[model samples]
Target: MSATPATPGTPDLPALPVLQADCSNCFALCCVALPFAKSSDFAVNKAAGTPCKNLQQDFRCGIHTRLRDKGFQGCTVFDCFGAGQQVSQVTFGGQDWRGHPGTAGAMYEVFPVMRQLHELLFYVSEALALPAAAPVHADLRRALAETTEWTAADADALTTLDVGALRGRINTLLLRASELARAKAPARKKNHRGADLMGARLAGADLRGAGFRGAYLIAADLSGADLRLADLIGADLRDTDLRGADLRDAIFLTQAQLNAARGDAKTKIPPTLARPAHWSA
Candidate 1:
């Protein structure tokens, strides 16, 4: 799908509402707070806390329209989950890093922290959207609310947080959410342990209550498949397309595993598997 121009003040757009990349209300936070290695995805190596040379006076990407062509595919894929806006508008009260140069370093520190919290909220919100994860919806909702509150905190409070530890706790909750979402799929009748099913097409197939323990499913197309109540312990799920698959009640699905899997809006994952913020139409 082609990218659509965002109408000012229009709530609906092709991209996820919660995942919009708002640079206007930001301090070029991602450019400064995140490090990028020299690769096909980025033009050059940039250290953390250093602003990208391409950042404009207004905190916008100078080559925004040609980021991908300019070897900035990584930048195109990074999403702040609205953290940029929340920090710029709420936490710092619309203050720019330039206006208060003294706070520049501190603002840079807070940006990454806010990004982490916002990313957690993104996953929690996705989990709540699945009707099949009702068993753990309450926990997911509470986590989402708490993470949202953290994103709105003052820069000082956010700068001092043990972000890694907080991320670990949030990851645990997301792991539980994935299990709940997968459990909703229909139960498989038989076990398929350690099967190599790479690139196998199983769209709209019913594998309910089936045991898929330690299966090699690399590049498998399982779109629109019903995987309810299946046991998926230790499965190699890299590059699997899960769009439209019903994974409610699936067991042993981990965040790392889902992270390795490819999915889109139509692909329903456990709340623990936060939607990749960079995904767009």
Candidate 2:
């Protein structure tokens, strides 16, 4: 968890902004909608559409602070990308499934879909913010508008929506955005797309603008690595060491990804993200 040395008086850069989860505005849909197996990641076997054992009547996690301590590390790292609020507030009109038993089934089904759509929003928002993606700005804006509109639909409408098809189209556009961004650092080593880098010893590697899409970097040592503008879409970072790494402008990194990784005070992160509370100094 050591940081690379920086010159005195150097200032941190602005953090990249993206659609993020606001758990406070949510009704804890994740606790009810998703299932988990009893493994290292979770302490119990849970079924889909059923509430977890640790969920309180107030719709808050009873063990939120001690999730990892209690072997529910998966819960600690999961992010809904703002879907929980959209589902609880917008889609269902503040009507909780628990209050209306009939709505529980539909609510659970739509929650995952909304999570996926919100995830797309995260990417679109990121692409729109990238100056290098100006060539596709028009298309990105259009997609954002359309997706925003779709997210406003009610439960039945959401259930029938072809979210997978929509995701495909967005992925295509995002790939272009990534290409444009990575073009900034052409000399950097970046062709590790979808590689199994689990527990890889990549500490201090110069990974500027690298493509880490879908890479399994579980417990990988990334301390002091320069990860600026790196494409981190869908990268698994559970227990990864990121202390002192520069993740500024890294593409497609979610709060979930950051929460899952281990870092220290010296790790540079996007301005939009807060350092995980669990991180060691």
| Winning model by TM-score | 2
> Backbone clashes in each candidate structure, one number apiece?
23, 1
Using all chains and alpha carbons, the TM-scores for the candidates as numbered come to: 0.64, 0.91
Could you give candidate 2's per-residue lDDT for residues 28-62 as a string of tens digits? 89999999899989999999988999999889899
**Model 2: which ten-residue window has the lowest total lDDT?**
1-10
Which one is best on lDDT?
Answer: 2
lDDT of 1 by residue, 194-275 (tens): 8989999988988886767679998899888877667676687766788788775456555555655677677666654567
Displacement of residue 233 (Cα, Å) in model 1 is 16
Off by over 4 Å in 2: 1-18
Model 2, residue 96: distance off in Å is: 1.1
In model 1, the worst 10-residue window by lDDT is 1-10
Judge candidate 1 at residue 264 and give its lDDT: 69
Instruction: Name the lDDT value of residue 166 in candidate 2.
Output: 98
lDDT of each: 0.69, 0.85
